[model samples]
Target: MPTTHLTPTTVITGFLGSGKTTLLNALLRHPALEDTAVLVNEFGDVGIDHLLVDELDDEAIVLLNAGCLCCTIRNDLVGALSDLRTRRARGEIPPFRRVVIETTGLADPAPILHTLLSHEALTDDFRVDGIVTTVDGLHGERQLDQNIESVKQAAVADRIVLTKTDLAGDTTTLRERLRAINTTASVLEAVSGDIEPAKLLDTGLFNLHDKPPEVTEWLRAVDQDGWSPDNGHHHRHDDGIASFYLEASQPLAIHRFVTWIERLLETEGERVLRLKGVLDVEGSDAPIVVHGVQHVFHPLTQLSRWPDESRRSQIVLIGRELDEHAVRSSFDAAVVG
Candidate 1:
């Protein structure tokens, strides 16, 4: 199945008191997120509560709450999504183009990603847009140093939204720390929860209207050339989690590439918080993009055409205590094969 046209889902996660709700509340009021569906652990979570919820459908779900679809997540997220789909088909709720799930403050986030990307029933209709993490400028540094979950949340994000900059002076050190945790992620500040929704969305490869996936933007950090096997500079966070990348100028044999990915995931999948890249498979005319969260990798997405003239295979990997040389050597073996 093609990735295009699937309702992109964004997971918003952060530590307690990190302003996930504050940012979400401001985003809910924004017109850009008006057509979006928001899922939270409980309605009691007041992330979007500031908005006026107009209508309520029976069965304890808030439909189009805050001028958008808002629902409380039960024990299983799958059931909630299924119910929403059913209601949409029955015209019970307004049609939505995207979805945002707000995770609890202490979440690891890998399990949620696996569910969204690999769940059999949900994959056909929903695709993961990206993970947006909120970090409190005042407490982000302390959280990262003291809490492993907070570090993980920041480590795997596609975008890190730093809140309370207005109150916290000189977040430069905090920003640097975040970049150290995940160099590939875009670090943005949401002072008083003011941010452009566009900066946070569209972080995934797929797009709406069945359009071509934005392969380039999905891996834009590759353009920065951040990682190297010999930089002698390592960015290490809690549990030795770090960001790195491997690239090949020439096309790689599909079999070898697949084998490397299998071995890598089989051994280091849990450590691999996120892995995404564009591969120039030897026998293919267009590039194939691969995205994975932990052990679950999405189906290979071969684009209609390359996003740009750059045909090099670029892979960005975020994991715990990853050995750069070993990964480079293993990748070289695959490419040389």
Candidate 2:
């Protein structure tokens, strides 16, 4: 796949008490971030955090009063992005090139990314540069061991920011443990939410040229063979937590593909934690990438170029109590039929 450079939008996601708000507040104060737009989602009955943030420029901050970005209120997110584009066109908001979405502490970022990447109205205007996950340095090790969402956030991020290092008894040990889970992500330290803004932005999906050898090796590991149902490497949180993959070499029959996906949602909606993948469909010039969490699915998106030369369809699934073999078999049956 040839490289296509687009203006990057970064997402900051982590568990509650991960200092996401603190990091945003600090970033907003940076001189380099003068022209950036910040989208904040606060999950609560009454939204008060919007008032806490000091918006330097007029209309620079848009707060989604809705509780979570992954819920039905996600339409509000689409509206907010649309509004941002309108304001930019009318010169109402600052002419910003970067967008930063801060998900609620308990929020899962996969759905939000799906929205940003798959929204028809928004994709033409913005691209996901990368995901920056903030892990509490003090509690990160324990959190990764216990919290399934936290682990997913770490696994999918292009960059991981370790916050509260000043309080963490052993930053070195925590960092090592994070590396074990996700060795490809660049790990940076933050003290009191203070870190260089440039480091957190623009780390795109695939870093082919300048990445370390280890990172390249890790990227290769993303192939279908890397994740097999026979392997005991499945994610285990509750019976409600699972992670698996789906792969297809032949292009999917578009109509059948739609039916298959819809049926999955109808049958196992609640248990579907996160689903993302690149699909090769007949009649499409490029691969269609889809993302969803729980019942909400952003519109399917087509990348200008494949992330790599591997044109085969490959998807990663995160669900709870969902049988990996059954899901894969069902998808295969649909394609064959």
Candidate 3:
């Protein structure tokens, strides 16, 4: 069950003044996020900044800080992840079931996601479980307008935590802007970065034991059999990013669909921000779930059975300036054969 049971690694990122730190601190304290290794820029928090005693074995990775284990990213995320795995296997450090990485405010999340998905040392043992972006509800709209990085962060998010919403009066415009960028992402409000850890976990297909209903909703556009926005938002995307689903009722040849995905990623990976779906493969009774970011993808999750009676396959793509007709025609060609 190694393939099915890989450790979930969620990247938490947002722009300056976006409440990312507040959210990270909140999430790290929760019992739900326990047994996790948190990688941060600096051990800035009081209880977590203490140095480990050499008698503990090595000073490279620290543990028992706060409730969960801790490691300093310090600018080397790949090194941190690789080191954690090796140390965990050797019993040099406390075992952690999952990982949570907090990116710098100005950093782009794609590189961390790419490393999680494609890095040789970590790919097999870890999977890109989710991307949670904390947005400053009061000023999120301004940040999105002024910062391309903020736009991309929100565009590719799985769960958008709108922090300080209680104080930000009338957030209708901000929500609409977010909806336009990523219609599929679930938008949750957090007052002073107060949000449940359970809402953010399992954004991808992992640790989904007996949660069929939730997983089914995760696969976008349940009622539609054709192209549509996952959320009920209908607006032209002036920012050049769009999210749409391609659906088919009949089972698809897994090989063909996968081949198309590979070529798509190879050719236009940078433009493709996120890809997710639940598929009814030709030979399989159970549904196969797909999740990816940029050029890399998670090992497909083959469920025990269809989440619901809806065996239809729907592939959701969120990207910039995607050629909808060409993509759909190509999908049709794959299905036709």
Candidate 4:
């Protein structure tokens, strides 16, 4: 589809001391990442992270200082992005196809997501490919148990990477805890964010090809009756984490679908951690994949090829206190007659 032409930008985030910077440094050296630009956010006035990268002739790196890029520092983000475009136009920075944003350790990624989703000019120029969150395997369990922001970070991740796995005392327990919080997120291991860079990027929402067979099967396993509160298989934890599937057998009316999504944002915006799905619109032959963080929704990009023969609309939602029954009811009610 024409929409597939849009280049994907990956946002890498994690709580403080989660090894995000280590991952970015490692990724910068990857041969495949030659045509990539790295955007870094430093929590203080001194920006030394940018100086740490060993610059190659093919890559470009820029750092945003001090303020978090989401709110107080958003204007800086806009200016930097604009500067990147200008440099690309003037042939200064390498002709990069991908952009990576690395937020500070304490940053709440939702605001950064908002800038990418709600900014008019930025949306036209870039598409959110996916969000990759690094969790400190040793401390992640404790963080999730005690920290609300940490819970939010894990909930919104497209890929949850367990960093510093070598130091984690009980890897299995940590993995189990993460799964309980967000069952649909792909969990990966990274000694020092040293895994293959290709695996970390470009896994757009509903890109079944990138998912393990079990995940693909999980998404396709949605019940025909639609999501309901009584489903015994659905899981939840005390920290407001819940997982459920939503499916539509028939192609959805575009306007109705949009309206239902808006209603979702209005009702449980803050609690919604992450949502991803493939929708077969009523009139469009190609499938559109939707991705969102909290209330911020990325532009739906149509796929060039159906990942497989299955064309049914399916979505996986992971959130805090998300009411599956209410969400399903609203969607069903919004269906065009």
Best first by lDDT, ranked:
2, 4, 1, 3
Q: Between which residue pairs do clashes occur in model 4? A: 1-304
Model 4, residue 82: displacement in angstroms?
2.0
Candidate 1 residue lDDT tens string, 1-337:
5778788888889875576655776687778886777676522112222111222212323322211111112225776787787888798788877777876564555445545655576988988888899998866787688677787778778889988787678999999988877777889989756899999998865222232123233233322434222231132225475556677888888778887888888887766655667788888998776755456555676645664577878776756677878888988876653
Q: What is the per-residue lDDT of model 3 for residues 1-337, given as tens digits with 9 covering 90 to 100?
A: 3556688888788864466655765666677876677765421122211111111223333332211111123225555677888888999777888887766455545444444655567777889888888887766886687666787678668888998777678898999888887777789988745788889997764332322233333333222322121222121223575656678888888888888888888888767655667788888887776755556654676645553476788776766688878878887886645
Q: Tell me how far the alpha carbon of residue 32 in candidate 1 is from the true structure, in angstroms, after superposition.
A: 1.1
lDDT, candidate 1, equals 0.65
lDDT by residue (95-175, candidate 2, tens digit) is 887788887655555456556655677777778777788998766776677666787677667888898777667788878
Output the lDDT of residue 147, model 2.
69
Off by over 4 Å in 4: 55-59, 205-337
Model 3 TM-score, 2 decimals: 0.52
For model 1, name the residue pairs that clash.
none
**Model 4, 1-337: lDDT tens per residue?**
3446555778888865577766776787788787888888865444444433444332377778855664367667777777887788799766778788888655666556656654666766777788888998766776677555576667667889998777666789888877876677889988856989878887773243443344333333433323222332232124465556677888888778877787787778777665666788888887776755566565676655454477777766667688889887777788633
- Count clashing residue pairs per candidate: 0, 2, 0, 1
lDDT of each: 0.65, 0.68, 0.63, 0.68
Runs off by more than 4 Å, candidate 3: 42-75, 206-337
**Candidate 4: residue 52 lDDT (0-100):** 35
